[model samples]
Target: MTGLRPDTGRQAGTMLIVFGVVLLVSSLVVSAALAPSVGAAGNDGTPQTLVGSQGGGPGLHESGSVYLLDGKETKWKAAETDSYFDVTMLDNGSVATGFMDSGYEDCEPYESPCTHTGFRILEPTDDGGAEIVYEYSFPVRTRSNSEVHDVELLDSGEFLVSDMEYERIFTVKNGEVTWQWNASSMYDAPADPTTTDWLHINDVDALSEDRYLVSVRNANQLVVIERGEGVVEVINKDENGDGTGDPEVLLQQHNPQWLNNGSVLVADSHNDRIVELHRNNTTDEWEVAWAVYEAEGVPFSWPRDADRLANGNTLITDSLNQRVVEVNESGMTVWSYKTPYVPYEAERLPEGETVGATTYAVNEDATVYGNGDVPVLSLLLILFQTGIQVPFWFTELHVGVTLVSLTMTIAGTVLIVRDR
Candidate 1:
């Protein structure tokens, strides 16, 4: 019996060593299979393959400038000092951007109650720089330049701007407010006097010549206001009357865009999702017809804007993730662009329109890759396919083996260090 015990111990130790070796081999195989593809998928000073293959033009140009909002002060100083709050590509190939001199800083030393906030329209020159054809300035009470989140150029040569501090949306034509709507009464003010940004109206879209769609972020609602009338319709309204905007469908949302079908697509920002609120024909109530939370198992973080493209796919600015992802109708990420700066909005200009010649260079050091020539989504799909097709037991075994290998590797390295 004593002799048998020693044999059993030796057998058990041998089995453990064998299992550890097998695990190491399996882990190496898995790593070899995945690592190369991922490394090759990086920008690596070359264009990446087009992801999702929706046939959307040349994707993002290799060295073209986009009308982007660089939200970070440090990064903006490194890139360009003319840091903007909102940038939009005009139909005429020009770009319009909203800028603040002090960058959301308090209006101090100037002695005025307003900060220097303004908009500029730049026309592309032959030398890859823009020519500012027009400029307009305004004073906002808030310390943050976020008071104006969007600027739209109308066919009538007017501008539609959102002012959050005073909770109002106004139109400026010929440097004057042609039309304006005050939403102060619709929202409850914060208890603290210092908190001037109460409603935090982050977006405004001109639905028609007379109507508009505005996203009240703090209210957790989208209000469609007509020029003459007050609030016409509210999406995600406080139906329960709890005063806290209870059961809020959209929590701290932004960029509510009106669709051709009379529905609205909103970036449900705080909820970390994009939702399309469709108006019911019978009940006249707005219902969520479509949503894209996590496409292809990739979740969004603080997405600020989402635009439905001409091809029916949704172009989203996954802000906190520092990336822009284009998801198809089936919720598959077909295209993505990793930006160096925190992107606040992403819009696909019409086929012929362009944002002119200003090109923001890509940061090669950043790991996330997209907007080049490589098909990253395809590689992820290969991994996903392998995961699904493999037998359950085999998959479990591979995972177990990989874990065992990892444990042994760590233990061995520790032992070697301890012995030394």
Candidate 2:
């Protein structure tokens, strides 16, 4: 062009170098901004790749699998059962689980009646099969698809079970209902009775000898009901006493446990957080004493359970994330285990407790991906970093350099295409 300018080649080379440098710097910034958000463990913040094997930190005895730390560990896991909901290791070295076989499709054939819900207490044998020593089943009060999401064996040889469709908690002893608290009258009847589960009570925990903590998920409240007096104190409820009013704190919560320090630890499920609420002695109101939502780059999604361990760490079941993490008081992850399937709850077994010799298979079909897969926040951070760099490059770089760099990029692309 014009007898081929002598400096054209040198100018083009400089522009290309500037363009490449800009891209490299932008990439570095983006990567640095996103790196810390990945999941890690321990106080040192060391990144860990979670494996679904036995042998690590404390064992997570969960619904579908058992993860342990000893090399010579024994594990006993059963195949998926019908209506599986809750599982726990009993003090007597047995396992108890709740089952409810009712849903919308389950009642399609039987219009007026449906399948019942039940729980079983089993003793794990040395060979890995469990012996059903005790079992109980119950029918729904209304002809709907009632389910038992939680069950606990009382010290008095009774059972405490949460019935979702019925919106009630039943206390059964000797396979007979000793006492029950009905929550149907608390809220107005839903417009669609056939499909609506009004309260959706998901968890029940014994606070003391006479007090019980109930997690009413749909109602967005935790109630401390005296064994005989019904609801004694309602946490996270509107002070105006309106059943349809907005929740003060909780939102579609799950497990609620009483801490020794007169605080209640609860999994605020829909809010994607775990919170501990303590009653203020002076104001006579529930106050958020402590909470953990997103900590040290790991975020919780629909967490269903949070158990405070003896070591002052909190073992949390990040349900939607398909993983469980143990975090210290400062919300730093000390240990973590990723599950191939969604885990509803996780508990740390005592030092000598073992699940026996079995490897429970994860339901590959039921696995739900959440924060652990392609973290949304991290992607957004990358985009934000790139956005900030664009303005910086335009304003900070010389105007001639900026235009020349962009032109050279476009010319390089055109040259490559023409050569091809």
Candidate 3:
């Protein structure tokens, strides 16, 4: 009778306990192993929640309403059609954003469907609305290509636009391309031939009235292109018969920004770093001064746009890491935010400069929030326990499993974010 008994309640209870324990243990382990090797800004040494959806307008680094128009939706904001690439604040309190609008209604009132026009400089209106005071467009009969990536107010109305694809740099004033810098003229093939990945053109920053700093990603090089009316003088090499120049030797870089002190700030994307180059930066006679990387031990997963703050700090967009990191000159991460989605660019708000640079990290923190009942670390430990998938997600690959672990860890992370 004892051997041929029905399934007992005690045995059933034991199996349930065993299964729950094993499942939980496995989840925590997977989560811990694949947790982002480095912690995010405002993390405070604990796994914090990823907050806010990507592209939502909020100030992650300062106070005031700010939004990043990621080229996809700037049209809705009246900077119609152009996908925005770069933005900067002008000396007169207006903001200049570089974007490409398809059906551009130009300052000269040129025509519609202008095909990838230049930057749009927006001035603040008295009622919180915006007015497009300047829309820089190429002059008629001007021989140059289309498409621009960045914009900076040259004076009150003059500006610089980095026309990346066409390999041209356009100088604008009161909505006209006054002078042009042809990048194709300097190179054998107008930019060392596009890499198999399709582009070499990147960020461009002004050094002075006649000199410039240009980032060519595919070539993985940064060189100065001297702009003059009717000619673009390039100093690629001092190769033949003279001590005239240093061959624009390959300096691994993607984006280069300018500092007021004649120093250049560069974003080394592949290496995940930002460098500072000075010496001959302001006018001609420019040379690299020093280099900085990923805010000391905090390696960025994929750092993109960066800026040097007036208070001696650097605001960096750790793109793939989905965060914005602020590092003081001492290399301490004074602030950070593990935003929920990719942050392509970060700028410091001058009004908020007393707190350092301003940045708006796209946060997605509450997507998978956890209740306080769960122990954050324990939840993490269990996710990665098996070094495999937790099975609930229906994947077999360890990498996929590892990703799930990341998700769980983020869930626990958000729980502690506001505290940080």
Candidate 4:
């Protein structure tokens, strides 16, 4: 084997090391330069907003919170759990949301330090805090995909909950199950739905006293269920006999808002966009009326909730982006607020999310935001982002820089070893 002179090898190694450090530092500077603004602090006369954060990871790994915000300022906070999911502001000024926490007893089928999942009603105090006035929870074997992801207060004084543990949508009154619609009845039944994440029924919204809109996330479909009757209608129905629905229509979607009888708004989570679908009266099929892929120049990173506000704007919880944004009909961001870690859902106060707005129809060739991301790099970044919180400004440029830095560092190590 041939080797370079001692001084030459040392010089090359040192130069490579210096270049690697410079590239790494430069990437950090670029990331800071591209950082988003803290956003409008209620200056736009936006109403108070309620946010549910799902923390950084699964149960016991990260701590989540439910908070009330006036713009970017936290007016009240409740952070006693591992994750906080769907949130609703009640008529009496209290908030109802789903939550998960660990360190509970009677964790059967699993080991000690198990998790509990359920819904709680929180009342805000005058001292920038909240107290859980009412709670109804149960122990789960595992933390992932076993929590109650949504809760709604019904007119009959019962709580409608989405139970992922049993793969069912049920209403509970005074700790008793009043009613339930199991997924196995409609879809193909698994041997054991509780053993794995079978359906991931994450959301349930009471459309009427007896009608409910349910989001079957893993199936990539939403079903409208009427009491006593099974699935009345299926949006994004699987026509090809496949177990999952059409991804082009919806893929692992969340928090779908029923906007009138003809249209609906959904956060197409896996597609990284907010989509508005209108029922084609002629064909009786749902079509994308409008969609936005990005807001405030940042590509949406796994947006989990989108609500069509009463003021014709849409409130979106951009989960991985760690911000909530309100955008006008033209896809222009009207107001934005930076949040901490990952946020699962957000709602604008006072008017909240009311049904039926003047649906806007856009041309088929309307402008849509697109981020020119490399395919493999984008996937890697997404996996990293879902597991850990990445900075909003960490873009392809940063990825490129980091890769170059790693290559240089490896080369430097090789050179030093050869010299030795």
Pick the lDDT winner: 4
Give the least accurate 10-residue stretch of model 1, judged by summed lDDT: 48-57
Query: Which one wins by lDDT: 1 or 3?
Result: 1
Q: Which segments of candidate 3 are over 4 A away from where they belong?
A: 1-29, 32-82, 101-117, 124-134, 137-147, 190-199, 229-252, 259-263, 278-298, 338-341, 351-420
Every model's TM-score: 0.62, 0.63, 0.54, 0.92
Superior by TM-score: candidate 1 or candidate 2: 2
Best candidate per TM-score, number?
4
lDDT by residue (106-216, candidate 1, tens digit) is 455344555555566767566544566886765555435234666778777789888775567888988898988877556655654235656777778777767788887
- In candidate 4, what residue range of length 10 has the lowest lDDT sum? 368-377
Q: Order the candidates by lDDT, highest first.
A: 4, 2, 1, 3
Model 2 pairs in collision:
55-68, 56-69, 74-356, 75-356, 75-358, 76-355
Distance from true location, Cα of 181 in model 4, Å: 1.0
Ranking of candidates on TM-score, top first: 4, 2, 1, 3
Model 2 / residue 374 / CA error / Å = 18
Report the alpha-carbon TM-score of model 1 versus the true structure. 0.62
**Model 4 pairs in collision:** none
lDDT of each: 0.56, 0.58, 0.47, 0.84
- For each of the candidates, give the backbone clash count: 8, 6, 43, 0
RMSD of 3: 14.4
